[model samples]
Target: MEVAEVQKQYIRELLIKGRKIEAIKYLRTNFDLTLRDAKRLAELIDEDIADDEYIKRPGPFSGGGVAILTIVFGLVGVIMLGVAIHLYTSNRSFVREAEQTVAIVVSNPSQPVFEYEINGQTYTYYSNVESDPPSYSMGEEVPIYVNPSNPNDVLINTFMDRWFLISLLGGMGVIFLGVSMLVFFAARAR
Candidate 1:
């Protein structure tokens, strides 16, 4: 016979009442619990723990290696972000002192396309709509955005490089598949 949850609770209560020996006997007779199980359960209740959930073990490709690589990239990205921030902060004075040059919106033909020259490099930014450039002139000055530390760090156009992200995921998937194949072959060999 299988022991019910309520019966288990009743046994637990008896064990907590300092009648552990009696509880074990009752559990063995009524619930048909083994002496070891009754004793272990009683101990758990005495310690105020509800239950234990067993965790299933992971095989080699729980795909944790891909996650590890992603973590490495994230760490590198954080370092890059820090470097950019520092450059911006340190070059603030230089940027303020440098002459701001205006580049006309050649594409929009009507909007102001501002260009800033810093560190012998030309940095450009569009006004208001940085994501989308409105039609306008070759010499029109809209607005120029620049990095305070390094002017070379810039956005040349509004286009997004989605291929980079796709390539990264594809690379990780290929690596995982390769590693899994290796593990499979190695296991077969053994």
Candidate 2:
């Protein structure tokens, strides 16, 4: 559950300044907290704090919670990066070992299709290649690398074809990593 607000600090400050009515008013106006809730909060604050010093207490979303969220984001980023790396390596390896041929491009609703020939046999593969306005035009010849054992497995040997997914995932991973590091450091500092 998400907290509506953090009024504890403000309430504590008001209590420290000996303005109980203002503290209660602030809680009611800002957080929509009931009188009982405001009084309860005031009492809790009074019990925990002394006259000279304010003891810092952990709330629902303490530093620990922030740390946990950081870990979760970091893990997701690592998983995405790992999958991207695996796909990139596998595609590169397939291109290096598979038979090279030229495929005729055909227009499709979702994406362009590739029609290629292998040992007098024609095979059609839906391209996963992403581009605005489509990269290959109808009747265009594109370089194709297909697995010898399983002809269905194909790869288009282009920078966008080979590196788009990897780049996207790697970029996301970097962003998550950066955010997690920043959150972790900030939480620690706090």
Candidate 3:
């Protein structure tokens, strides 16, 4: 909204009284100006009036949108972490009874694809199914654990294969929680 001449004069008076930050906050509340625009306008007012009243101040970080986003991100991270933990435990249990064999890395265009033989039957597998990084070179031999009941079910024998999802989701959770804490504390500081 366009500020009336009287309102503009009042804003200038506020700036002259060393209330430039308050003037900007007032502009943000009363006008349609963004925070950046309000700050810039407040600074311009000080420059034009030859006053040193304008002092940059940090704005509020707390908002409903930020709170909602923090909750959503934190919840998703927790859910992913939970799934990873569950799969890791299940894989561990299976590995205790599963058969171990060597699988040869056959090809990798986007993800690694490998094959192994069990009882004269060749089984093809994609590394993307495990979400493990494609660290294997072509023809490289890697150990894998295959479920005894279902030969098709397998797990790569590596620390990353076991804990990758857990680490990823935990890291994301920490980051989201950290952001939320920063916003929460910064708002409270004011």
Best by TM-score: 2
RMSD of 3: 11.9
What are the lDDT scores of the predictions, listed in order?
A: 0.53, 0.78, 0.77
RMSD (Å) per prediction? 14.0, 11.6, 11.9
What are the TM-scores, per candidate, against the unseen true structure?
0.29, 0.62, 0.51
Question: Model 3: which residue pairs collide?
Answer: none
Off by over 4 Å in 2: 1-54, 57-64, 107-110, 128-132
Where in model 3 is the C-alpha error above 4 Å?
1-63, 107-110, 129-134, 185-190
lDDT-better candidate, 1 vs 2: 2
- Candidate 1 or 2, higher TM-score? 2
* lDDT (tens digit, per residue) of candidate 2 on 1-190: 1223355776777787667789778767776789998777668776776867654456434647776889988888888888888987888788778999999887762378889999889999987655677776789888889999989998887777778778999889888877888877776674
- Give the per-residue lDDT digits (tens) of candidate 1, residues 1-190: 4667897777767755556788778867776689998777667655763334223344443557744555555555555545545544545544454444444464443344456666666555544433335344466443333545556443322222213333454455556555555555554453
Query: Clashing residue pairs, candidate 2?
Result: none
lDDT rank order: 2, 3, 1
lDDT string, candidate 3, 75-145, tens digits: 76567667667776777798899999999989882377889998889999887643346577789988999
Query: Which rank order by TM-score, best down to worst?
Result: 2, 3, 1
Q: Could you say which candidate leads in lDDT? A: 2
